[model samples]
Target: MIAQTLSQLRQLKLTGMASALQTQQEQPGPYEGLSFAERLQLLVDQENQERQQRKQERLIRTAQFKLKAHAQGIDYQHPRGLQQSQMAALLQCDWIRKAQNLLLTGPCGSGKTYLACALGHQACLKEYSVRYVRLSRLILALTQAKADGSYGKLLKNLASFDLLIIDDWGLEPLKAATRNDLMEIMDDRHDQSATAILSQLPTDQWYQSIGDNTLADAILDRLMHNAHRINLKGESMRKKLNSLTQAEHLG
Candidate 1:
């Protein structure tokens, strides 16, 4: 009867339940002592756990974050203006749920990209679809999409993500066409999805960087109207890491 039950579970593709049942039968000390209802509950719990794990794996795989950053690993001790209380509140992912935007501004290596990616990772854990791309790369890709007649389709696909992490914003001046494309993308996501922008430039200079006053106003208004800002102020984290490495070598 045990063998038949195992075969049936395998045929039904209940691998988690089957594995749990096998362990229960082979190493039955604790499981044997449990009532039938408790044993059944244990098997169900195992299957549910397995399903949840698979779902989270899928979310992470599809997110495509440049860095594997997590909220737990953030360096609160660094002099960067990151506040633990603010991060704690953001970790709940209510901002994404509310379709608000986040702007992370800092100098090079101030952990802007890391923080943005960390928030994106948190969003994925909360089962929100996310995509991470550098702004320059995104613009280049969109330009190519335009050439190939897939621009509309690409915008739709980008808009589908619940959280979009755009890193390295303002790395280059935008062309007129790219500005238009950006406005379209922002419009699609404006009141529906959340965008996390990581930029080395301060928000004040963004208009001049964008170059076109009219388009810049439209894009910045949509992005900043309901946005939360984090201005990271500290020495470059990369330089600090390099210095530590040099010290270790000298010692």
Candidate 2:
């Protein structure tokens, strides 16, 4: 009878509940005194927890973040101008729910990408869909999408994510086509979805890097307005870590 019930639970796709039932059958002593209603509630709670875990895993896999970072793993001791209170607020993901943007700017190797990825990870935990892509690659992909006649579809897909992270912003001058593509993306996400940009270049230099006053104004207006800014300042974290590793080897 127990085997048949377990089989039925599996067939019904209540795998978590099925596993819990099997455990209960194997070690009945723990739950022997509980009422049927209480035991059933435990099974339901396990099923809900398992479903939530699977969803979080799927969301993280789809995010494709460059670094495997978590909000809890952020190195606040790195002296990169990261404030604990600010990060705490960001981790709550209220900004994402409100459709706000984030800007992270700093010198190269100052942990900008890591911080962005950490926030992306946190957003995933909060059940928000996220995607991380470098600006150069995004532009290339947009150009390819245009050639392959999927430009509109691509735009819609890009705009669909709850959090869109663009790294390596303002690395080079943007061509006219790239500017227009960026315009389309920013316009679609404007006031509707959240975006996070990681850049080595400061925000002030972004206009010159874009090379078009009109397009820069439009793009910056959408991204910069109501955006949370984090300007990091410190020595290159990469080099610092390498030095520490070398010192440890010497010791």
Off by over 4 Å in 1: 245-247
Evaluated at residue 5, the lDDT of candidate 2 is 92
What is the lDDT of every predicted structure here? 0.91, 0.93
- List clashing residue pairs in candidate 1: none
Q: Model 1 over residues 189-217: C-alpha lDDT tens digits?
A: 99999999889999999999899999999
lDDT of 2 at 143: 85
Model 2 has an lDDT value of: 0.93
Worst 10 residues of 1 by lDDT: 240-249
Question: Which candidate leads in lDDT?
Answer: 2
Error of 2 at 16 (Å): 0.9
lDDT of each residue in 16-91, candidate 2, tens digit only: 9999999899999999999999999989998999999899999999999999998878888998899999999999
Q: Taking the candidates one at a time, how many backbone clashes does each contain?
A: 0, 0
Listed per candidate, the RMSD to the true structure in angstroms reads 1.8, 1.5
TM-score of 1: 0.93
